[model samples]
Target: MSERMTTATGTRDFLLPDLGEGLSEAEIVEWRVAVGDVVTVDQTVVEVETAKAVVDVPCPYAGRVVALHGAAGEVRPVGQPLITIASLEGGGDDPHATYREEERAGSGNVLIGYGTGHGGSGRRRRRPRLALAAEPTAATADPTPAATATPTTGGATGADGGARTAPLVISPIVRRLARERGLDLAALHGTGPGGVIRRADVEAASAAPAAKLAAVPDSPAAHVGLAPAADGDVVIPLTGIRKAIADKLSRSRREIPEVTIWVDVDATGLLATRAAINAATPDAPVSILALLARICLSGLRRYPQLNAHVDTEGQRIVQSAGVHLGIAAQTDRGLVVPVLRDAQQLTTRELAATLAETTAAARAGTLPPARLTGGTFTLNNYGVFGVDGSTPIINHPEAALLGVGRIVDKPWVVDGQLAVRKVTQLSLTFDHRVCDGGVAGGFLRHVADCVEQPALLVANV
Candidate 1:
């Protein structure tokens, strides 16, 4: 959901509302409504992809569509105008005047952080009423002139030579590029839809001087020492989730003094325990991951230091009051961590059900930004990838990550006799700054003890 701003005229500018987990920006995925369409409050107008999830952004104001900001694949910083709408009733002065009882089936607040608007069941379309009197300001617009989706255009209203408007730029990244290169955005004519400044526009501008320098012998461009792509090389520009993962992992590696400790645990008892529970209740089956999560929660209770964040600015370790367990699930886009809040408070059955729901949502790519962030610790089941072990990077600020490798039958010693048991490797990677090896080892061993002896869980109960 988004916030709205009032103008002297009937049109209101809808700022991209805060998609919480406190994300700063999101890329426009697609537009659900077009210009000339009528909308109700909480009606999803656009879908945006944050680093963590794809969220439906509902417009807070109920009105006729005037213009859309930013095209698909474009990233918009939070608080930037998302759309323009003209109120259909009440002279556009009061944004909520058009609300009807039937249109709102939901609690009126749907988007996790956007509390200003309620959800609507349907929207009615009418003949185009609002004129494209003003061209939607440039680069930030997210529609297409094409039929499939959003509006792509030239300028909207106030384009006359008499009135000066700020240059339209596609996204904050494009603006950042121009700033870093000291390229004046106003000087460049945007080639994107609606004459918005795009990244290419800035690159082309920056390359002009470099292009000239390249022609001169022994010029600075040649000595810049940048490598050129080979013929037939497929260059993939990092965007969206991949770029976010890179940034986070890069930050973690750069900031944390990390250490990984691992142990091979006999999971035969855990497997049998799962079978017994499922056999007793065939309708409600629990996953191994859920059990592992329960174990992690208990271990955190024993050693709270691992369930915490290092407040580097304050030089303090903030132990979380409750476990907000993050589960890493791989999707087509990338790895996403969907958090389960207050995980320690749930019973095994409750935890399993919620885990199933959360993981399913993650795989479907429908999790809201709020559900994707704010984890005290992360549990990664790299075992699904058929790997035996990994030195995983901690999910930044969080003190530790627990990784589970694939479970396989391996030879083992029990009661001084050779035996084959179901075994898995458990690895813990923690921030050394938070606690020493003793604390880390204690937590890891506690988790292993639970896995090796599922009956030990009764003690916690």
Candidate 2:
């Protein structure tokens, strides 16, 4: 045979970038392109939700997507191959191959001020070689490198005398965990990022016998959320929305210095305004969330200082010109905050329509990435859940978040007279680094004033 094509060949694997967030891993929440699909450089190939935020990962090489290494909803580790791009034409060698390599090297250069610089090595660090090869049996034993291969139902050779068993496939994260726990992959059932055996699955399988026995009535394990005679271990995987929530909250807690202020307000006028708006627009029913969103937008306009975000790069606060209000919606998957762009420009009816559309999309898991970004402020309505008050966390990249509490009849002094007025609690949490207590208090008062006297907002309109 003539010389086989080597680097001259068109196919190249695209590894998952660090996304510049300094995170070692990310969950591939969505795949925008598939195998055999034509993709251009810089085109969004996958949507990955990092611990910090949801980011659209662009393709490094422009070519036909030959294969996707992992399935969607799988968590791929950093620097691992995610996609394979093959050149459209095959020949002795492509002239632009070197340029493609350079681009691949630069693919980790994400502009979002998130991802760290790509390390020099193209391949991930290999695992240490196993020492002793332990034969697979009913007995649990540490496996050696040579003993890594387990015999399936088929023998070493098939009926036709070909190699019988397929190689075991596992994800990088699973492999790392397996190495850490000294887990024998052959013995564990995979229930993780791909069919890769996770740590929890291994632990569960190991505890299964005891769990089954404990299922009997009056077992101590059963009384304490475990199996009856045995303790049933409950395993919850950190993936998708739940994973995102954990990551975001963790980052906010670690990075930002947060302070919260609470104020009780008369919500009678706000409720009336919402009812009037809904009656006026029968096609779109206005919700208390929309009303709170409008009040936040108005408050942001009055106190523009609160409408700013801390720029980590510049080490300064950048105030936004307009308001993009994010509404925290509880979905089956988890919590999603969808933004209503230019909330300052939208009328009550328009705001209601937009909120309805976004919430529906969030619930249906069909929200576009664009609609989920660029939020200057966020509103979490604990009121719907009958919560009177809650100190909400600030959505990072935004200065503040407003929590709207349930409205209830409570006695208050109105003009020095005891009266039962419809009251609601407003909790405002801000980044102490960028916002002072006075500014936060003023912003909260402004929102409360708008809510207590809906006429004030109408006057501006």
Q: Pick the candidate with the highest TM-score.
A: 1
Error of 2 at 127 (Å): 40
Worst 10 residues of 2 by lDDT: 127-136
The reply for model 1, stretches above 4 Å from the true place, is 1-10, 87-109, 117-230
Alpha carbon deviation, residue 355, candidate 1 (Å): 1.1
Candidate 1 residues 146-173, lDDT tens each?
2112333434234255444556653544
Q: Would you list the C-alpha lDDT of every candidate in the order shown?
A: 0.76, 0.66
Per-residue lDDT of model 2, residues 50-92, tens digit only: 5544555655565677778776456888888878888667524
Q: Give the TM-score of candidate 1.
A: 0.70
Can you give the TM-score per candidate against the true fold? 0.70, 0.59
